[model samples]
Target: MIFAIVGPSGAGKDTLIRGALAARPDLRLVRRVITRPTESGGEDFDGVTPEEFARRQSLGHFALTWEAHGLSYGIPRDQITGPGDVIFNGSRAALPEAAQVFPGLRAILVTAPDILLAVRLAARGRETAQDIRSRLSRASFEMPAGIAFRTVINDASPEIGIARLLAALQPVRA
Candidate 1:
């Protein structure tokens, strides 16, 4: 199963996944190909230029792809190996498409109040006030009908969010 984690820019999706990994080494964290610079912190992804990303996408290297915040992100076709649950930092808009690729895909929607999201985004310093506002405005998304999913409110610490994710994944694991 591919467990795709989706949320707004500063919802701490990476932070929650980092904690979940520490607790469950059996779970795999799928690295993504992103247009962001490699030096940018948070999720560790293969950074590529727009040209390189386009070339790779054209070669059928990616199983899923999406654009957000003026950047492109992709999940390589090879990353969708069979069997165990593989976790990925994914976009909310692409969840249905990912589910189509991995039929047993489970979505974990990490979210927080708009106020909290704005604060967290500001703290990251990755985007300006205007950029953060734009993100916050489009924060909510309607999940594709019938896609197995659960929502986790990451309003507090990463530890709390991790616990919620683990609990949500328990039934799916069983």
Candidate 2:
């Protein structure tokens, strides 16, 4: 099963994913390829130039690709094959295409309140004030229909959020 972790910025998706990984070593985390600089840290991902990203995408290297926030994100075709339970940070808008590619895809929506989101985003220091506002504005993006999903409200401590996420993932464990 492929678990697509979807949420708004600053929802602590990376934190929860790291905790879950430590707890369950059997689960595989897909390292996504994004067109953002590696130094612009958030989650651990392979950052590449737009030209490089386009080159790879054109070579039939990506199983899934989507554009968001003026950047291109791709999930390499090799990463999802022969996996145990796979997980990757994914876009909400790309869920439909993801489902079409990986039929048994399960979406894990991590979320927090708007106030917490604003604070978290600011603390990260990855985006400008205008960019942060732009992200916050889309916090309420609705989930598309016809996808199996579980929601984990990351509104508390890291420990609590990880516990909730693990609980949500229990049923889907291989």
Candidate 3:
């Protein structure tokens, strides 16, 4: 199964995914292809430019790619070949196309109140105020409707929030 976890910037997405991986050794995670420069201590990735990304996409290098915040994000189909279930925390904007390519796909859209989101962004010390504001202005995340998402976790209480997400993976009772 493919599980795509997405939320706005500063929504504790990378943190939650890392924590979940530590807790659940059985889970598999996919690193994304990005145009953004690699930052210290951030998730690992190969940097591709818009032109290179477009060239590669034409060659079918990506299972999916999307434009957002003046950057390109991609998920290569090659990585989705293994049997283990996959987990990725990325842009919701990447979902529409990504889901269609991978069978058994699901989404987990993480979100918090706007005020809380800003606070989290500030705490990260990664983005300038202007950059953060531009990201927030994208308004890319909202409750995903009609998608077979496992669950939506509020980051207010992260420990319990992750537990709820893990629980949602289990078979539901009638």
Rank the candidate models, highest TM-score first.
2, 1, 3
lDDT of 2 by residue, 56-154 (tens): 999999999999999999999999887478989999999999999998888999999999999999999888999999999999999998877999999
* Candidate scoring better on lDDT of 2 and 3: 2
Q: Which residue segments of model 1 deviate by more than 4 Å?
A: none
Q: Write the per-residue lDDT of candidate 3 for residues 1-174, one digit (tens) a residue.
A: 778887787767777777778788878878778887766246767677777878888999888777777778888878777876778866676666666677667787776667777888778777789978877775455544555665555655778767766776555467
Taken over the whole model, the C-alpha lDDT of each candidate is 0.87, 0.93, 0.73
**TM-score-better candidate, 1 vs 3:** 1
Model 3, stretches more than 4 Å misplaced? 138-140, 143-145, 172-174
Once fitted onto the true fold, the runs of candidate 2 whose alpha carbons sit more than 4 angstroms away are 172-174
- The prediction achieving the highest lDDT against the true structure is 2
Candidate 2 contains a number of clashing pairs equal to 0
Give each model a TM-score.
0.94, 0.96, 0.84
